[model samples]
Target chain A: MTALEKKFVSFSVAVAVLFGVPQTVSAMHIMEGYLPPAYCVAWGAVCLPFLAVGIITMRRLVRQQRKTMLLLAMAGAFVFVISSLKIPSVTGSCSHMTGTGLGAILFGVPVTTILGVIVLLFQALLLAHGGLTTLGANTCSMAIAGPLLTWGLYQIGKKLRVPRLPLIFLASMLGDLFTYCVTSLQLALAYPSAQGGVGASMTEFLLVFAPTQLPLAVIEGLLTMLVIMGLETYAKTELHELREGRRGLFHDAE
Target chain B: MTRNKKIVVVSLLIVVLLIAGPLLALKGASFGGSDDAGSVKVEEITGGEAEPWATPVLEQLIGGELPGEVESLFFCLQTALGVGVLAFGFGYLVARKKYGGDRSGTAGDKEKNS
Candidate 1:
């Protein structure tokens, strides 16, 4: 296939899985049995080198500023703590922050890859939000799509020349939405049910998760944007240095 | 000079975070575990059980045994690799284009990178 055709096919598969398929499969945490051993092993193996690469990149970023490293670590820790402290949402479910949107926006995708690995490790080890066997899938869902989509939305916003706040906000919002949507799609694809299985139709799954997730995405996006914008406005010096890489932005904001 | 600029930015980020680090922490302490611990609560939902393409695999895994079939393993591996590579490669390119430095350079001029 041509490049455009390839892109189109990929896009169609994503949409088909996310919106067109059905069932209430728990895609995000990726329940243990849902993945084949080989898939898990292969992904886990591939993640090994990427994890090294991520560490190298982070070390380079950190060597520039020890405090920036500490701050990012703290930010990651804070995310772990807050997300673990889940709040009640719908009757049968609870929700927590994914924290990927802002992480992607500020640090870029490479660093977010590291951040994702760390966050997932902590969440699994300490909080038990996700299990160890399924860590690969979880990392792929949040770390991969979260940052990728965040960067994509940011570019779209840049091309449109929207204001900085709106740009960041929209980017974050869409990033969060796509992260959850992708996770849902991943689950559906992993576990396709018969016509009358417990898994709801893809549209039904979308309807169920979308209401809560869409609003949560907006909330998270705004929160992240506001924090970033607040630093930009009131603490421009800190932000300038942080953005410049001399000082970390979260260091001052926190 | 450009490298110095980068260093300066990184340094500033460190100091700023050091000063502002505590605020990122979630406050207050939980004195006790949540009420739901060890409680088996049945949730009533409005959906029927759906069929699965890999129901046997799912059942086996849930039952604490890995699937013995090689086809299942290949299926999962193929999907995982495809998605993993897509996620990593595309994600890297997007980030590089947006924030790695300058964006004026063309992103996808050659097939090798893609």
Candidate 2:
């Protein structure tokens, strides 16, 4: 309605369009029924507490800044679009950036985890993007583990006074790569190698996914940086307010 | 160049690579979902006697795997719902903030714009 609101809407559209274009977004997920029932339940359990924390954090953020709700919703949409955009690389290895690291950088690990899980669930149940049985493993790799690692590295980078843009790029890329590593490890564990056991199986799975994932990680890093720059230019005030405390979800609100 | 322009340029470049890089770099790429590939690999490695430890409830309910077109439809619907939820939430937040919802909030956003 207001001029500022219109401005926010337009800029948000720009950001969304960056991801909205229908590319060959490989639904690069561990397909449905890939994981055993026990694994699914265990992974689901692993995600529960994280989601609980994420909910509380989001609540605090909303209370702190009503605009946070808008930002988060937009953020969730962005993460969903970006992560889901697939490139058809790698013959058999479904390669796409896990799309979590950048979200983690913007909102921290916990919040990103919530978005990742929500998207993963919809992708699995509705679109068959991934299997329901392996939602836990997928969530763990793409949401929890990857984001935490990315945010941790980002925090370290901030402490070291690294340049902001480069640090973000590197951190997010590492996060993307980390997701694949965990995915490979999960698969390896599920089906240990008869020859070399977990280690060999891990190596094989890693090799299988590596070629596609590595390049995607680099592209993800660049794209994340670009998106951050756009947000900073268009949404500077929000960004400043957001990183004010900078400790974690708890700090941002306080 | 302006920051916004630079961002647009960089983003477009990334987009080009994301779509085209795969076509150029990867040959024999089925571009298939990893699940199918991973499952096949598992079967091969495990001596072709492998069985999935579980089946998705939805798959069972639907009587089998969904047709590809149906799967795409669901994905589109999910995306539409997600975008709708996000847009509504953003609008609501801005509206709430304008209505003096936050502690010190006001139409400060409007004043700046005016």
**Per-residue alpha-carbon lDDT of model 2 for A1-254, expressed as tens digits?**
33553464455445433432231111136766766565555566666656656666666677665555555776787666666666676453465567676578878877888889888887776666677778877887888888888899999999999999889889988888888888878777777789899789878777677776877788888877876775654454566667763466424343
> Model 1: how far is B83 from its true place, Å?
34
lDDT of 1 by residue, B1-114 (tens): 675355445544643453233223323322121112101110112232322224233334556433446434543443354345334533444454457422332333333347
Residue range with the least summed lDDT across 10 consecutive positions in model 2 chain A = A19-28
Top-scoring candidate (DockQ): 2
- The lDDT for every candidate, in the order shown, is 0.49, 0.69
TM-score of chain A of each: 0.72, 0.83
Give the per-residue lDDT of model 1 (tens digit) for A29-95.
5543345554454445434433444454466566554424533553454344323434333222334
Assess the local accuracy of residue A184 in candidate 2 as a C-alpha lDDT between 0 and 100.
79
The C-alpha RMSD in Å for every predicted model, in order, reads: 15.1, 11.0
Each model's DockQ score: 0.03, 0.29
State model 2's lDDT: 0.69
